[model samples]
Target: MKSSEVTSLSPPPFSQVLSMPTSNQGWPEDFGFQLGGTGPSYILSVEEGSSAHLAGLQAGDQVLEIEGHNVSTLGPQAVIAIAQTQKNIPPSIGVVSRIQQV
Candidate 1:
């Protein structure tokens, strides 16, 4: 993807998103898409009112890790490919809840 393609306010193409690695490692507890483009590093651009954005994930925070996997090396395409193998995953983010919170 080109640098001009990705904007901080818009969600990139499906090719730019990644799924949380199912590996039994120390991955981050949250989930969302990773913005891909020429820049300093990886970033998480949460959809407006999404679980991630609602949870306080800003547009510029560097994504350190996902499912304990170092995203810095996987890049955008690799991550999106991995995430695609999973079924029924939403474009916004991934989550698992036990029950409704009081």
Candidate 2:
């Protein structure tokens, strides 16, 4: 079977929205999640007990949108830049959670 056929046979990824509020300092790190990826930025890690962790963000979650901006085709830096633009308000992050198949 082709790679496309194999991919099609797998279940589709599910999406979830995370409302993460930044700290008073308003920095990307304050959001408690590390982002990494070139195209389609993804969450590298979620700090324990942090806003992102509480908001249900997990490592490997593919970022679909950030603060209402589509980031599906953006690099990590661009995505982080968009995230940094938000101040005290909680930014709505759209993510696709992929489940690893055994």
Q: Model 2 Cα RMSD, Å?
A: 13.0
Residue 18 of candidate 2: its Cα lDDT?
A: 49
TM-score: model 1 vs. ground truth: 0.39
Candidate 1: tens digits of C-alpha lDDT, residues 1-102: 656665567656664444444441211223443455343234445565444555665555554444444554555555555444444332223232222447
lDDT of candidate model 1 versus the reference: 0.44
lDDT of 2 by residue, 21-83 (tens): 434335447777788888978888988877788889999899998777889999888887787
Worst 10 residues of 1 by lDDT: 90-99
* Candidate 1 lDDT score at position 91: 28
Q: Could you say which candidate leads in lDDT?
A: 2
